[model samples]
Target: MLNKKQTNTIEVSSDIAQVIQDGQQLVAYMAKDGQVSLDPDLAQVMIDAKYKLQKKQWNAQDEAHFLHSYDQLAKAVAPVSMESIRAISRSDNDKPSQAEKAVAWYRRYTLVALICLLFVQVYYLFGHALAHDLKDLYESRNEWHLKLDSEEPNSKEFKQIQSKYEEVGQRLDANYNLLKVWNRIWLMGFSFGSEIPPYSQEKLNVELRRLERAQADANALDNLNLAQTRLTARLQLFENMLFAQSVLEVLQGYVLPLLYGLLGAFIFVLRDLLREIRAITFTTDSEIRYRLRLTLGALGGMIIGWFLNPQELSGLASLSPMAMAFLMGYNVDVLFAIMDQIIDKLRGAMAANDGSKGKSIQGSGNG
Candidate 1:
């Protein structure tokens, strides 16, 4: 039958009682270790707070007095121990502040964003694998064409090369079919106004048919070469299109770097959050600051990718662009420091150039 206000008061009272109990236990341990000797006035406040809590006379004012006394008592203990006690108090309290609720929401949002980035990375990996397979197929087809050119028509070696060429062609057709479907899905919105026209399955089929006919005729070397040339050209076009899609559609300059940066920031924030929670130093302010840090990290990653060449950095020359972006995002300060150094060096070089120019002018005047 408790009203909302009464229910909240009851909850607050329970939370205060738990905090006071924990404080008392910590104080007792500190006393045993000769690290604390509570003031008489603070001791009396604790006694009164306990008596009121036990008698169900607890109220907001009593809770405040209890908290103040607990703080004063804890001041004598090690800072780390005090923070641990506060952390426990916050953890036990069921009611959260509005800011804490907002932080919780943002934390979930960051996690979701990270998961989306992971999916994109996996998709890119699949595309890269497909591209590699296509490259190998193209090379195999080229090798067969070379063998076909050198071998005499209708000979056993020519027949063997022709059979292998047909097998490679079949594999290319299957791969092209898969690529078309993958392109549609992967490049859905990004494929508009592309210079390379959509590869026609009909054209591919016709060329394949002509190649088959030439193979059957055996003596039609000109027809065989023409069909092989057309088929190879078609495959090369598909390879170029796939490469463009990977570069322009999937990994548009800043998109991957931004995602990598965000992932790095998320990791750093998550680690920091855990550490702060353990130290009982996490607050609404810290949560808000972390949100801004995440943004800066993403931006830092993109900037590093755009402006900072990995080759210019001594030890970091081995890192890929994406890897560099991640590192920049995780610690934007490093990027900033590097930028500062570059700026300073540029300024120094300019100053030296200006000084030399002035000396040359002075020498000419003397002459």
Candidate 2:
């Protein structure tokens, strides 16, 4: 129990052979219970008398001295409220950068790159697919020619025509081939400003001659009709395929990965984002949840897109290669649009909030 009027004495061993009167400024404070005490060196700074006398004895306001410094600490600490305020002010002024700005820039760049990469990766794969489709079309046309050679198209209906041929197969393979060739030539021109490959020149020359003359004596010329039709169809398919191939080559080689790099930036940025979230909060639940959801959604869409495989679908359903191409193009367009929109939305969501500022504000307030 403490009594307000009582001045409790702290027993000091007066056994110092003799008191150094000069150092008498040092005082001891005893608690109201009389037994509890702290030495000046170990005491709460507010009660150190030696430091106080040291301040009072010094005439220099700019003491530039440890004695004055000790007294100043004692004086400042004597008032708890002032001490608290000074602490807060110091905290407000002190700022160690968290590297968040750099991280944010990385995130932004990554997001932008993700979009470009999405288009790029899709284009790359689509181009590879297109080249494969072109090859298939060419080979199929060759097979058709062999079939034509084997079959007698008179009287009896053509077996495969009756069964496999349809509205799709009706499109001219020759025209498609021509279109593909022209595209290839244009691509070559763009790349090196050079002529197209000479590999198919002989076939191209023969096809051109037949095309020029096939217009005359339509019925009498019918003897060579099947051969011309087969050749022309092959040309058409080749043309269309060549164009698609060239486009894919450019996109895949030059554009896709470049864009992917951007997306990879996003991928990397997001990783850091999650790390930041975890670092700040000491938890990964939110980041993991969002990332899992995002990954699953993207994977599901890719799988769904794969279901629209043009090759098997075209073959089984009796669609022409041209029609199949159109169908695939349309489907891919729709899918790309959907995926793009979803990505845009996700990035928008991610960009919405800045959580770091709020944490700093609270820290400052505490300080």
Put down candidate 2 lDDT per residue, 249-366, tens digits, no spaces: 6664434423433343345435655564333321234345434434433333333333344454445366532233223332334445656877898887766544666778889999
Candidate 2, which segments miss by more than 4 Å at Cα? 1-103, 157-168, 171-262, 269-367
What is residue 213's positional error in candidate 2, in angstroms?
A: 15
Model 2 steric clash total: 25
Model 2 weakest 10-residue run by lDDT: 16-25
Write down the TM-score of every candidate: 0.62, 0.34
Query: Given candidate 2, what's the lDDT at residue 292?
Result: 49
Q: Write the per-residue lDDT of candidate 1 for residues 34-115, one digit (tens) a residue.
A: 3457577877777776676676666676788788878877676645464344433434457764435544766887788788
Candidate 1 positional error at 347, Å: 1.5
Q: lDDT of each structure?
A: 0.71, 0.44
